[model samples]
Target: MLETRSLTVRFGGQAAVDGVTCAFHRGTLTAIVGPNGAGKTTYFNLISGQLRATAGDVFLSGARITTLPASRRARRGLGRAFQLTNLFPDLSVLENVRLAVQAQAGIGLDFLGLAARHTALHDRAMAVLERVNLASRAAVPAAALSHGDQRKLEVAILLAMQPRIFMFDEPTAGMSVDEVPVILDLIEAIRQDRDRTILLVEHKMDVVRRLADRVIVLHQGRLAADGAPEDVVASAVVQEAYLGVRAGDV
Candidate 1:
Protein backbone atom coordinates (compact mmCIF):
# COMPACT_ATOMS: atom_id res chain seq x y z
CA MET A 1 0.00 0.00 0.00
CA LEU A 2 1.34 3.39 -1.07
CA GLU A 3 -0.15 6.86 -1.37
CA THR A 4 0.91 10.11 -2.95
CA ARG A 5 -0.51 13.40 -1.78
CA SER A 6 -0.56 16.27 -4.25
CA LEU A 7 2.77 15.12 -5.66
CA THR A 8 4.29 17.71 -7.99
CA VAL A 9 7.57 17.93 -9.88
CA ARG A 10 8.67 20.85 -12.05
CA PHE A 11 11.62 21.52 -14.30
CA GLY A 12 12.05 25.27 -14.62
CA GLY A 13 8.77 26.43 -16.13
CA GLN A 14 7.27 23.03 -16.88
CA ALA A 15 5.54 20.74 -14.41
CA ALA A 16 6.22 17.13 -15.28
CA VAL A 17 3.98 15.74 -12.52
CA ASP A 18 1.36 18.11 -11.25
CA GLY A 19 -0.50 17.67 -8.00
CA VAL A 20 -1.26 13.99 -8.56
CA THR A 21 -2.80 12.17 -5.63
CA CYS A 22 -3.54 8.46 -5.73
CA ALA A 23 -3.50 5.31 -3.63
CA PHE A 24 -2.15 1.87 -4.49
CA HIS A 25 -3.96 -0.76 -2.51
CA ARG A 26 -2.41 -3.91 -1.10
CA GLY A 27 -2.43 -6.99 -3.34
CA THR A 28 -3.50 -4.95 -6.33
CA LEU A 29 -1.75 -4.39 -9.66
CA THR A 30 -2.23 -0.90 -11.09
CA ALA A 31 -1.12 0.28 -14.50
CA ILE A 32 -0.06 3.86 -15.24
CA VAL A 33 -0.53 4.63 -18.94
CA GLY A 34 -0.30 7.68 -21.15
CA PRO A 35 1.29 8.92 -24.35
CA ASN A 36 4.88 10.06 -24.67
CA GLY A 37 5.96 12.66 -22.10
CA ALA A 38 2.91 11.96 -19.96
CA GLY A 39 5.12 12.01 -16.81
CA LYS A 40 4.38 8.39 -15.92
CA THR A 41 8.03 7.56 -15.36
CA THR A 42 8.67 10.92 -13.74
CA TYR A 43 5.99 10.20 -11.17
CA PHE A 44 7.65 6.84 -10.50
CA ASN A 45 11.03 8.49 -9.99
CA LEU A 46 9.52 10.93 -7.56
CA ILE A 47 7.90 8.26 -5.44
CA SER A 48 10.94 6.00 -5.56
CA GLY A 49 13.24 8.88 -4.53
CA GLN A 50 15.17 8.86 -7.79
CA LEU A 51 13.81 12.37 -8.36
CA ARG A 52 13.00 14.81 -5.60
CA ALA A 53 9.49 16.21 -5.62
CA THR A 54 9.15 19.96 -5.80
CA ALA A 55 6.05 19.73 -3.60
CA GLY A 56 3.81 17.20 -1.85
CA ASP A 57 4.57 13.88 -0.17
CA VAL A 58 5.04 10.16 -0.78
CA PHE A 59 3.87 7.63 1.78
CA LEU A 60 4.52 3.93 2.00
CA SER A 61 2.06 1.99 4.12
CA GLY A 62 1.06 5.22 6.02
CA ALA A 63 4.53 6.56 6.87
CA ARG A 64 5.82 9.58 4.95
CA ILE A 65 9.03 8.98 3.02
CA THR A 66 9.22 12.07 0.86
CA THR A 67 12.79 12.89 1.85
CA LEU A 68 14.16 9.35 2.01
CA PRO A 69 16.95 8.63 -0.40
CA ALA A 70 16.63 5.88 -3.00
CA SER A 71 18.76 3.39 -1.12
CA ARG A 72 16.87 4.02 2.09
CA ARG A 73 13.59 3.61 0.32
CA ALA A 74 14.82 0.35 -1.17
CA ARG A 75 15.82 -0.90 2.26
CA ARG A 76 12.33 -0.07 3.47
CA GLY A 77 10.65 -2.48 1.03
CA LEU A 78 10.58 -0.59 -2.28
CA GLY A 79 11.82 -2.37 -5.36
CA ARG A 80 12.30 -0.83 -8.82
CA ALA A 81 13.14 -2.34 -12.18
CA PHE A 82 14.04 0.13 -14.88
CA GLN A 83 12.93 -0.01 -18.51
CA LEU A 84 16.54 -0.45 -19.53
CA THR A 85 18.40 -3.65 -18.79
CA ASN A 86 20.75 -3.06 -15.86
CA LEU A 87 22.96 -5.93 -14.76
CA PHE A 88 26.55 -6.97 -14.59
CA PRO A 89 27.22 -8.37 -18.03
CA ASP A 90 30.32 -10.17 -16.85
CA LEU A 91 28.68 -11.89 -13.91
CA SER A 92 26.92 -15.22 -14.15
CA VAL A 93 23.16 -15.08 -13.78
CA LEU A 94 23.37 -16.91 -10.47
CA GLU A 95 26.07 -14.60 -9.21
CA ASN A 96 24.07 -11.49 -10.05
CA VAL A 97 21.02 -12.62 -8.13
CA ARG A 98 23.16 -13.99 -5.30
CA LEU A 99 24.62 -10.55 -4.77
CA ALA A 100 21.14 -9.04 -4.55
CA VAL A 101 20.04 -11.65 -2.08
CA GLN A 102 23.16 -11.15 0.02
CA ALA A 103 22.81 -7.39 0.03
CA GLN A 104 19.17 -7.51 1.09
CA ALA A 105 19.92 -9.99 3.80
CA GLY A 106 22.94 -7.95 5.00
CA ILE A 107 25.22 -10.92 4.62
CA GLY A 108 28.12 -9.08 3.04
CA LEU A 109 30.26 -9.16 6.18
CA ASP A 110 29.62 -12.85 6.71
CA PHE A 111 29.79 -13.68 3.03
CA LEU A 112 33.09 -15.44 3.53
CA GLY A 113 32.52 -16.44 7.14
CA LEU A 114 30.23 -19.42 7.21
CA ALA A 115 29.92 -21.91 4.40
CA ALA A 116 26.38 -22.58 5.54
CA ARG A 117 25.36 -18.95 5.00
CA HIS A 118 26.96 -18.99 1.59
CA THR A 119 25.03 -22.13 0.72
CA ALA A 120 21.83 -20.51 1.91
CA LEU A 121 22.44 -17.50 -0.25
CA HIS A 122 23.15 -19.66 -3.29
CA ASP A 123 20.01 -21.71 -2.71
CA ARG A 124 17.88 -18.58 -2.38
CA ALA A 125 19.29 -17.08 -5.57
CA MET A 126 18.80 -20.34 -7.42
CA ALA A 127 15.20 -20.49 -6.22
CA VAL A 128 14.54 -17.05 -7.68
CA LEU A 129 16.26 -18.04 -10.91
CA GLU A 130 14.03 -21.10 -11.07
CA ARG A 131 10.97 -18.92 -10.63
CA VAL A 132 11.96 -16.80 -13.64
CA ASN A 133 12.76 -19.95 -15.58
CA LEU A 134 16.43 -19.05 -15.78
CA ALA A 135 17.75 -21.84 -13.56
CA SER A 136 19.16 -23.71 -16.53
CA ARG A 137 21.18 -20.67 -17.51
CA ALA A 138 22.42 -19.87 -14.01
CA ALA A 139 26.05 -20.42 -14.84
CA VAL A 140 25.99 -18.45 -18.10
CA PRO A 141 27.15 -14.86 -18.24
CA ALA A 142 24.28 -12.41 -18.31
CA ALA A 143 25.48 -10.83 -21.57
CA ALA A 144 25.28 -14.16 -23.33
CA LEU A 145 21.52 -14.46 -22.87
CA SER A 146 19.02 -13.08 -25.33
CA HIS A 147 17.49 -9.68 -24.64
CA GLY A 148 14.28 -11.22 -23.32
CA ASP A 149 16.14 -13.50 -20.95
CA GLN A 150 18.18 -10.57 -19.74
CA ARG A 151 14.96 -8.73 -18.92
CA LYS A 152 13.75 -11.73 -17.02
CA LEU A 153 17.02 -11.72 -15.06
CA GLU A 154 16.28 -8.19 -13.95
CA VAL A 155 12.96 -9.34 -12.54
CA ALA A 156 14.72 -12.26 -10.91
CA ILE A 157 17.02 -9.87 -9.14
CA LEU A 158 14.06 -7.87 -7.86
CA LEU A 159 12.39 -11.04 -6.66
CA ALA A 160 15.50 -11.86 -4.71
CA MET A 161 15.17 -8.57 -2.88
CA GLN A 162 11.69 -9.63 -1.72
CA PRO A 163 10.23 -6.16 -1.54
CA ARG A 164 6.64 -5.68 -0.47
CA ILE A 165 6.03 -2.99 -3.09
CA PHE A 166 7.25 -3.37 -6.66
CA MET A 167 7.57 -0.56 -9.20
CA PHE A 168 8.22 -1.69 -12.75
CA ASP A 169 8.96 0.89 -15.43
CA GLU A 170 8.14 -0.51 -18.83
CA PRO A 171 8.90 -4.15 -18.17
CA THR A 172 8.09 -5.05 -21.79
CA ALA A 173 9.88 -2.19 -23.48
CA GLY A 174 11.86 -4.04 -26.17
CA MET A 175 11.00 -7.61 -27.11
CA SER A 176 9.71 -9.61 -30.01
CA VAL A 177 6.03 -10.55 -30.20
CA ASP A 178 6.73 -14.06 -28.99
CA GLU A 179 8.92 -12.86 -26.11
CA VAL A 180 6.40 -10.36 -24.80
CA PRO A 181 3.96 -13.02 -23.69
CA VAL A 182 6.58 -14.77 -21.59
CA ILE A 183 7.38 -11.64 -19.63
CA LEU A 184 3.68 -10.84 -19.34
CA ASP A 185 3.03 -14.27 -17.92
CA LEU A 186 5.79 -13.78 -15.38
CA ILE A 187 4.20 -10.51 -14.30
CA GLU A 188 0.83 -12.20 -14.04
CA ALA A 189 2.38 -14.75 -11.68
CA ILE A 190 3.65 -11.91 -9.51
CA ARG A 191 0.15 -10.47 -9.33
CA GLN A 192 -1.18 -13.76 -7.99
CA ASP A 193 0.55 -13.08 -4.68
CA ARG A 194 -1.88 -11.61 -2.20
CA ASP A 195 0.73 -9.83 -0.09
CA ARG A 196 2.50 -7.78 -2.74
CA THR A 197 1.53 -4.46 -4.31
CA ILE A 198 2.60 -3.81 -7.89
CA LEU A 199 2.64 -0.61 -9.92
CA LEU A 200 3.60 -0.79 -13.54
CA VAL A 201 4.22 1.81 -16.23
CA GLU A 202 3.37 0.03 -19.43
CA HIS A 203 2.53 1.00 -23.02
CA LYS A 204 1.05 -2.30 -24.16
CA MET A 205 -2.72 -2.03 -23.91
CA ASP A 206 -3.16 -5.78 -24.06
CA VAL A 207 -0.82 -6.26 -21.11
CA VAL A 208 -2.65 -3.60 -19.17
CA ARG A 209 -6.02 -5.09 -19.97
CA ARG A 210 -4.91 -8.51 -18.83
CA LEU A 211 -3.08 -7.52 -15.62
CA ALA A 212 -4.21 -4.19 -14.23
CA ASP A 213 -6.82 -4.26 -11.48
CA ARG A 214 -6.97 -0.49 -11.92
CA VAL A 215 -5.70 1.90 -14.58
CA ILE A 216 -4.51 5.47 -14.05
CA VAL A 217 -4.18 7.53 -17.21
CA LEU A 218 -2.01 10.59 -17.36
CA HIS A 219 -1.91 13.35 -19.97
CA GLN A 220 0.56 16.22 -20.05
CA GLY A 221 1.67 15.54 -16.44
CA ARG A 222 -1.84 15.43 -14.99
CA LEU A 223 -4.34 12.79 -14.04
CA ALA A 224 -6.62 12.14 -16.99
CA ALA A 225 -8.58 9.09 -15.95
CA ASP A 226 -8.45 6.61 -13.07
CA GLY A 227 -10.72 3.58 -12.98
CA ALA A 228 -11.26 0.11 -14.39
CA PRO A 229 -9.26 -0.58 -17.56
CA GLU A 230 -12.26 -0.75 -19.89
CA ASP A 231 -13.88 2.35 -18.47
CA VAL A 232 -10.66 4.36 -18.56
CA VAL A 233 -9.85 3.18 -22.07
CA ALA A 234 -13.32 4.16 -23.23
CA SER A 235 -13.21 7.57 -21.57
CA ALA A 236 -13.59 10.61 -23.87
CA VAL A 237 -10.69 12.42 -22.20
CA VAL A 238 -8.42 9.42 -22.47
CA GLN A 239 -9.37 8.87 -26.11
CA GLU A 240 -8.85 12.54 -26.98
CA ALA A 241 -5.52 12.69 -25.19
CA TYR A 242 -4.05 9.31 -26.14
CA LEU A 243 -5.88 8.28 -29.31
CA GLY A 244 -6.25 11.82 -30.68
CA VAL A 245 -9.94 11.18 -31.29
CA ARG A 246 -13.21 12.28 -29.75
CA ALA A 247 -15.13 9.85 -27.52
CA GLY A 248 -18.07 9.45 -29.93
CA ASP A 249 -15.75 8.19 -32.63
CA VAL A 250 -15.10 5.04 -30.59
Candidate 2:
Protein backbone atom coordinates (compact mmCIF):
# COMPACT_ATOMS: atom_id res chain seq x y z
CA MET A 1 0.00 0.00 0.00
CA LEU A 2 3.06 2.22 0.46
CA GLU A 3 6.59 2.19 -0.86
CA THR A 4 9.89 4.00 -0.84
CA ARG A 5 12.12 3.65 -3.86
CA SER A 6 15.79 4.42 -3.33
CA LEU A 7 14.68 6.88 -0.66
CA THR A 8 17.59 8.85 0.68
CA VAL A 9 18.47 11.98 2.63
CA ARG A 10 21.87 13.50 3.35
CA PHE A 11 23.21 15.92 5.92
CA GLY A 12 26.32 17.24 4.17
CA GLY A 13 28.53 14.24 3.45
CA GLN A 14 26.59 11.90 5.74
CA ALA A 15 23.59 10.02 4.45
CA ALA A 16 21.06 9.92 7.25
CA VAL A 17 18.79 7.61 5.29
CA ASP A 18 20.56 5.80 2.52
CA GLY A 19 19.02 4.25 -0.53
CA VAL A 20 16.12 2.37 1.04
CA THR A 21 13.82 0.60 -1.37
CA CYS A 22 10.96 -1.29 0.24
CA ALA A 23 7.25 -1.80 -0.07
CA PHE A 24 4.55 -2.27 2.56
CA HIS A 25 1.29 -3.98 1.76
CA ARG A 26 -2.10 -3.96 3.38
CA GLY A 27 -2.86 -6.16 6.41
CA THR A 28 0.63 -6.13 7.85
CA LEU A 29 2.37 -4.32 10.69
CA THR A 30 6.03 -3.68 10.00
CA ALA A 31 8.29 -2.69 12.88
CA ILE A 32 11.40 -0.63 12.09
CA VAL A 33 14.21 -1.46 14.52
CA GLY A 34 17.80 -0.37 14.82
CA PRO A 35 20.22 1.14 17.30
CA ASN A 36 20.22 4.86 18.04
CA GLY A 37 21.24 6.90 14.95
CA ALA A 38 20.46 4.00 12.69
CA GLY A 39 18.24 6.41 10.74
CA LYS A 40 14.96 4.85 11.77
CA THR A 41 13.45 8.26 12.54
CA THR A 42 15.20 9.84 9.57
CA TYR A 43 13.68 7.27 7.29
CA PHE A 44 10.32 8.07 8.83
CA ASN A 45 10.84 11.78 8.25
CA LEU A 46 11.54 11.11 4.62
CA ILE A 47 8.40 9.04 4.18
CA SER A 48 6.18 11.40 6.20
CA GLY A 49 7.47 14.54 4.41
CA GLN A 50 9.08 16.01 7.55
CA LEU A 51 12.41 15.86 5.67
CA ARG A 52 12.48 15.88 1.93
CA ALA A 53 14.56 13.12 0.52
CA THR A 54 17.85 13.97 -1.13
CA ALA A 55 16.94 11.44 -3.84
CA GLY A 56 14.39 8.73 -4.71
CA ASP A 57 10.65 8.76 -4.26
CA VAL A 58 7.77 8.04 -1.90
CA PHE A 59 4.71 6.33 -3.29
CA LEU A 60 1.34 6.05 -1.61
CA SER A 61 -0.85 3.24 -2.86
CA GLY A 62 0.53 3.48 -6.42
CA ALA A 63 1.26 7.12 -7.23
CA ARG A 64 4.33 9.14 -6.32
CA ILE A 65 3.76 11.69 -3.53
CA THR A 66 7.37 12.74 -3.27
CA THR A 67 6.60 16.35 -4.06
CA LEU A 68 3.60 16.65 -1.82
CA PRO A 69 4.01 18.40 1.51
CA ALA A 70 3.21 16.69 4.78
CA SER A 71 -0.31 18.08 4.97
CA ARG A 72 -1.10 16.96 1.46
CA ARG A 73 0.28 13.53 2.17
CA ALA A 74 -1.94 13.38 5.27
CA ARG A 75 -4.94 14.33 3.19
CA ARG A 76 -3.97 11.47 0.91
CA GLY A 77 -4.27 9.01 3.81
CA LEU A 78 -0.95 9.04 5.66
CA GLY A 79 -1.34 9.44 9.38
CA ARG A 80 1.68 10.07 11.58
CA ALA A 81 2.14 10.30 15.34
CA PHE A 82 5.45 11.80 16.25
CA GLN A 83 7.76 10.93 19.12
CA LEU A 84 6.75 14.23 20.68
CA THR A 85 3.13 15.02 21.35
CA ASN A 86 1.68 17.38 18.73
CA LEU A 87 -1.34 19.16 20.11
CA PHE A 88 -3.10 22.49 20.37
CA PRO A 89 -2.27 23.36 23.92
CA ASP A 90 -5.02 25.94 24.19
CA LEU A 91 -7.78 23.74 22.85
CA SER A 92 -9.73 21.30 24.93
CA VAL A 93 -8.91 17.65 24.30
CA LEU A 94 -12.35 17.13 22.78
CA GLU A 95 -11.83 20.10 20.49
CA ASN A 96 -8.48 18.79 19.40
CA VAL A 97 -9.90 15.43 18.36
CA ARG A 98 -13.02 17.00 16.97
CA LEU A 99 -10.87 19.05 14.65
CA ALA A 100 -9.12 15.93 13.44
CA VAL A 101 -12.46 14.30 12.71
CA GLN A 102 -13.47 17.47 10.97
CA ALA A 103 -10.41 17.25 8.78
CA GLN A 104 -11.00 13.61 7.92
CA ALA A 105 -14.52 14.48 6.93
CA GLY A 106 -13.22 17.40 4.83
CA ILE A 107 -15.11 19.97 6.88
CA GLY A 108 -13.83 23.50 7.15
CA LEU A 109 -12.93 25.10 10.47
CA ASP A 110 -15.80 27.48 9.87
CA PHE A 111 -18.63 26.08 11.97
CA LEU A 112 -21.44 27.89 10.12
CA GLY A 113 -22.51 24.75 8.24
CA LEU A 114 -21.50 22.48 11.09
CA ALA A 115 -24.75 22.51 13.09
CA ALA A 116 -26.04 19.35 11.47
CA ARG A 117 -22.72 17.55 11.85
CA HIS A 118 -21.66 18.78 15.29
CA THR A 119 -23.36 15.94 17.09
CA ALA A 120 -21.80 13.37 14.79
CA LEU A 121 -18.39 14.93 15.19
CA HIS A 122 -18.71 15.04 18.95
CA ASP A 123 -19.82 11.44 19.04
CA ARG A 124 -16.89 10.36 16.90
CA ALA A 125 -14.42 12.36 18.98
CA MET A 126 -15.85 10.95 22.19
CA ALA A 127 -15.64 7.45 20.80
CA VAL A 128 -11.94 7.91 20.03
CA LEU A 129 -11.36 9.46 23.46
CA GLU A 130 -13.14 6.57 25.10
CA ARG A 131 -11.03 4.12 23.13
CA VAL A 132 -7.93 5.78 24.50
CA ASN A 133 -9.35 6.06 27.99
CA LEU A 134 -9.33 9.86 27.81
CA ALA A 135 -13.09 10.48 27.75
CA SER A 136 -13.13 11.73 31.35
CA ARG A 137 -10.56 14.38 30.44
CA ALA A 138 -12.46 15.47 27.33
CA ALA A 139 -12.94 19.04 28.43
CA VAL A 140 -9.43 19.57 29.79
CA PRO A 141 -7.07 21.78 27.85
CA ALA A 142 -4.52 19.68 25.97
CA ALA A 143 -1.66 21.47 27.68
CA ALA A 144 -3.12 20.60 31.07
CA LEU A 145 -2.96 16.86 30.48
CA SER A 146 -0.07 14.78 31.83
CA HIS A 147 2.69 13.65 29.46
CA GLY A 148 1.21 10.17 29.13
CA ASP A 149 -2.24 11.54 28.54
CA GLN A 150 -0.83 13.90 25.97
CA ARG A 151 0.65 11.00 24.04
CA LYS A 152 -2.60 9.12 24.25
CA LEU A 153 -4.38 12.19 22.97
CA GLU A 154 -2.08 12.25 19.97
CA VAL A 155 -3.05 8.66 19.26
CA ALA A 156 -6.69 9.64 19.60
CA ILE A 157 -6.25 12.35 17.02
CA LEU A 158 -4.53 9.90 14.69
CA LEU A 159 -7.35 7.42 15.14
CA ALA A 160 -9.87 10.13 14.39
CA MET A 161 -8.21 10.81 11.06
CA GLN A 162 -8.56 7.16 10.09
CA PRO A 163 -5.60 7.32 7.75
CA ARG A 164 -5.04 4.36 5.44
CA ILE A 165 -1.42 4.09 6.50
CA PHE A 166 -0.38 4.63 10.13
CA MET A 167 3.10 5.71 11.12
CA PHE A 168 3.98 5.78 14.82
CA ASP A 169 7.37 7.02 15.94
CA GLU A 170 8.19 5.70 19.36
CA PRO A 171 4.58 5.86 20.46
CA THR A 172 5.29 4.65 23.98
CA ALA A 173 8.48 6.61 24.54
CA GLY A 174 7.65 8.56 27.69
CA MET A 175 4.66 6.71 29.09
CA SER A 176 4.55 4.97 32.44
CA VAL A 177 4.27 1.18 32.66
CA ASP A 178 0.63 1.38 33.68
CA GLU A 179 -0.18 3.47 30.61
CA VAL A 180 1.70 1.48 27.97
CA PRO A 181 -0.86 -1.27 27.58
CA VAL A 182 -3.57 1.02 26.31
CA ILE A 183 -1.59 2.18 23.30
CA LEU A 184 -0.27 -1.27 22.58
CA ASP A 185 -3.70 -2.76 22.73
CA LEU A 186 -5.04 -0.07 20.49
CA ILE A 187 -2.31 -0.84 17.95
CA GLU A 188 -3.07 -4.54 18.19
CA ALA A 189 -6.69 -3.87 17.40
CA ILE A 190 -5.71 -1.79 14.39
CA ARG A 191 -3.57 -4.69 13.24
CA GLN A 192 -6.64 -6.87 12.99
CA ASP A 193 -8.05 -4.65 10.28
CA ARG A 194 -6.75 -6.22 7.08
CA ASP A 195 -7.42 -3.15 4.96
CA ARG A 196 -5.00 -0.96 6.92
CA THR A 197 -1.21 -0.87 7.08
CA ILE A 198 0.98 0.10 10.04
CA LEU A 199 4.60 1.13 10.34
CA LEU A 200 6.00 1.36 13.84
CA VAL A 201 9.32 2.51 15.21
CA GLU A 202 9.66 0.94 18.62
CA HIS A 203 12.68 0.07 20.75
CA LYS A 204 10.96 -2.61 22.77
CA MET A 205 11.79 -5.94 21.17
CA ASP A 206 8.98 -7.60 23.03
CA VAL A 207 6.46 -5.15 21.66
CA VAL A 208 7.80 -5.62 18.15
CA ARG A 209 7.65 -9.36 18.52
CA ARG A 210 4.14 -9.28 19.82
CA LEU A 211 2.67 -6.86 17.29
CA ALA A 212 4.73 -6.86 14.14
CA ASP A 213 4.10 -9.22 11.25
CA ARG A 214 7.51 -8.26 9.84
CA VAL A 215 10.58 -6.34 10.99
CA ILE A 216 13.12 -4.23 9.12
CA VAL A 217 16.44 -3.18 10.59
CA LEU A 218 18.43 -0.13 9.61
CA HIS A 219 22.16 0.23 10.23
CA GLN A 220 24.19 3.35 9.52
CA GLY A 221 21.42 4.81 7.38
CA ARG A 222 20.87 1.78 5.17
CA LEU A 223 18.39 -1.07 4.99
CA ALA A 224 20.29 -3.89 6.63
CA ALA A 225 17.68 -6.52 7.24
CA ASP A 226 14.05 -7.13 6.36
CA GLY A 227 12.08 -10.26 7.09
CA ALA A 228 9.90 -12.02 9.61
CA PRO A 229 10.53 -10.58 13.06
CA GLU A 230 12.19 -13.68 14.43
CA ASP A 231 14.55 -14.10 11.49
CA VAL A 232 15.66 -10.47 11.35
CA VAL A 233 16.03 -10.22 15.09
CA ALA A 234 18.17 -13.34 15.21
CA SER A 235 20.31 -12.67 12.14
CA ALA A 236 24.05 -12.50 12.70
CA VAL A 237 24.49 -8.88 11.61
CA VAL A 238 21.49 -7.70 13.62
CA GLN A 239 22.61 -9.60 16.71
CA GLU A 240 26.24 -8.44 16.44
CA ALA A 241 26.04 -4.95 14.97
CA TYR A 242 22.64 -3.67 15.86
CA LEU A 243 21.95 -5.35 19.17
CA GLY A 244 25.63 -5.59 20.19
CA VAL A 245 25.20 -9.21 21.09
CA ARG A 246 26.28 -12.56 19.69
CA ALA A 247 23.87 -14.83 17.84
CA GLY A 248 23.89 -17.36 20.70
CA ASP A 249 23.07 -14.66 23.21
CA VAL A 250 20.19 -13.38 21.15
Q: Which one is best on TM-score? A: 2
Clash count (model 2, backbone only): 0
Q: Count clashes in each candidate, considering only residues at least 3 apart in sequence or on different chains.
A: 0, 0
lDDT of 2 by residue, 200-224 (tens): 9998899999999999999889999
TM-score computed on alpha carbons, candidate 2: 0.94
Q: Per-residue lDDT of 1-250 in model 1, one digit per residue for the tens?
A: 8999999999997999999999999999999988888999999999889999999999998999999999889888898888889899999999989988987887665535863457888999999999888999999999999998998899999889988898998987887787777778878888899999999998777888999999999888998899999999888887788766323334
For residue 81, model 2's alpha carbon misses the true position, in angstroms, by: 0.4
- Where does candidate 1 stray beyond 4 Å? 109-117, 245-250
Q: Name the 10 consecutive residues with the lowest summed lDDT in model 2.
A: 241-250
Model 2, position 184, has a per-residue lDDT of 99
As for candidate 2, its clashing pairs are: none
The residue-level lDDT of candidate 2 at 6 comes to: 96
- Give Cα-based local distance difference scores for all models: 0.89, 0.92
